[model samples]
Target: MGNIKKKKMIFLIMLFIAIFMIILAIISPLLISHDPLVTDFENVLQKPCSEYPFGTDQVGRCIYSRVIYGARVSLGTTFLLLSIVFISGLIIGTIAGMSGGIIDTIIMRIADAVLSFPDIVFAIAIVGILGPGMKNTLLALSVIWWTKYARLTRVLVMAVKDKEYIHAATMIGASNIKIITHYIFPNIISPLIVQLALDIGGMMLALAGLSFLGLGVQPPTPEWGNMLNEGRSYIQTAPWLLIYPGAAIFIVVAVFNTLGDSVRNLLDPKHI
Candidate 1:
């Protein structure tokens, strides 16, 4: 009982942090005191002070404001990217799993081919071919990200398709779409939810890494990754420049990961 209570408390704390970050991302621009992109050459590389809580970067832009605004880019991208991946994967996997035979084989093979390469490498190649930009980066990440969801959904659907409920639904002349939506989807959703929770952190990290590599958001965009990249040059002179954005990434990732783990534990049948 004590253990369960402790777990619940942890889950609530993580959940609060995650929700706070999302809300912060949405309202970041309004919260900033200075223009994130405006430069003041005289204030360049200023240490943290009353006027600039996070100090100024080499270009004299407000690091505090940039970091706040960056929440929108980083978190917003993760949300949008995952939404597409989840929906596309669900549709494709549902179709492949329900249809099976040649269709299943073909889809699975394509997924396997994509998965065979390391995700970062494939993302880099796609970004390189498509050229650097937010849209291109999203397209690149989405192309590879959906494969995992598709594979997981396919496996889950296959496992449960032969169950009595599915068989009964089919016998009742329910269409494939009806059967999948009404019967199969509900049973598989818990695991998918858990996967979504976990993948949010990974997607953030991947997007940040891409930005760090100069293939994402781009310069002066106020994105955490781009901020980190920009701040790298000043590591010796102004460590706070790097520290603030890096800490933002680390905290957001950690909270989401903890939330995901807590969700998994809560949803696990064995625990219940």
Candidate 2:
């Protein structure tokens, strides 16, 4: 009970932080101390003050504003990536799992081959081949990330395929498409939702890691990953730059993870 309550509290806190980050992203222009592009040669490396709560970056861009805007990119990428993965995974996994025999073997094997490579390696290789840009990052992320959903969906669909409703639907002369869509799809949705929440957090971290390495968001984009990359040189002299962006990544990831855990618990039949 204590652990459950703790998870709930953590999830709530994370939700609030995520919501605040979204709000900050939307109002960043008005809230930032100065234009994110404007450089004050004299104000370089100034510590956080009443005027600059998060201080200024090496280039004099407001750290607070950059962090806020970074949230926009990270969160936006998470949503886009998750949507593409979920939809594609659901369709592919469902078809492959329900079909069985040669089709199932072929699809699962192909998915396994894709999943064999390390996710970051696959992302970097794809992004490098596609060249640098946000679009490349999206392409990189989406290409490799879908396998998890596909594999999970396949298993869930297979397990539910033999259930009474699915069998009844098949016996009642329902077409394969109708049975899969109407009966099988609905039962697996809860698990899929939980997986999505967890995947979002994982993807956010991957995006940030890619950005920090220059394969994700490019410089001057005010993205959290880019900000961290820019701040690396100043780690010794100015740690706030790293701290602020890092915190933004940490908080958002934590929120998604917490939310995922809570949903998983709620959905578990034994727990309920």
Which candidate number would show the highest TM-score if scored against the true structure?
A: 1
Q: Clashes in each model (backbone N, CA, C under 3 Å)?
A: 0, 0
Please list the residue runs of candidate 1 whose C-alpha ends up more than 4 Å from where it truly belongs after superposition: 270-272
Task: Report the poorest 10 consecutive residues by lDDT, candidate 2.
Answer: 263-272
Pairs with backbone N, CA or C atoms under 3 Å apart (clashes), candidate 2: none
Instruction: Please give, for residues 1-272, the per-residue lDDT of candidate 1 as tens digits.
Output: 78788888888999988898899889997899899999999999999999999999998999999999999999999999999999999989987888899999999999999989999999999999999998999999899989999999999999999999888988989988798888899999998998999898999999999999999999889999989899899899899999999999999999999999888878766654
* Per-candidate local distance difference test: 0.92, 0.83
- Give the candidate number with the greatest lDDT: 1
Q: What lDDT does candidate 1 reach at residue 209?
A: 97
| Cα error of candidate 1 at position 121, Å | 1.0
- Give the lDDT of residue 30 in candidate 2: 71
As for model 2, its CA RMSD to the true structure in angstroms is: 2.5
Per-residue lDDT of 60 in model 1: 93
Backbone clash tally (model 2): 0
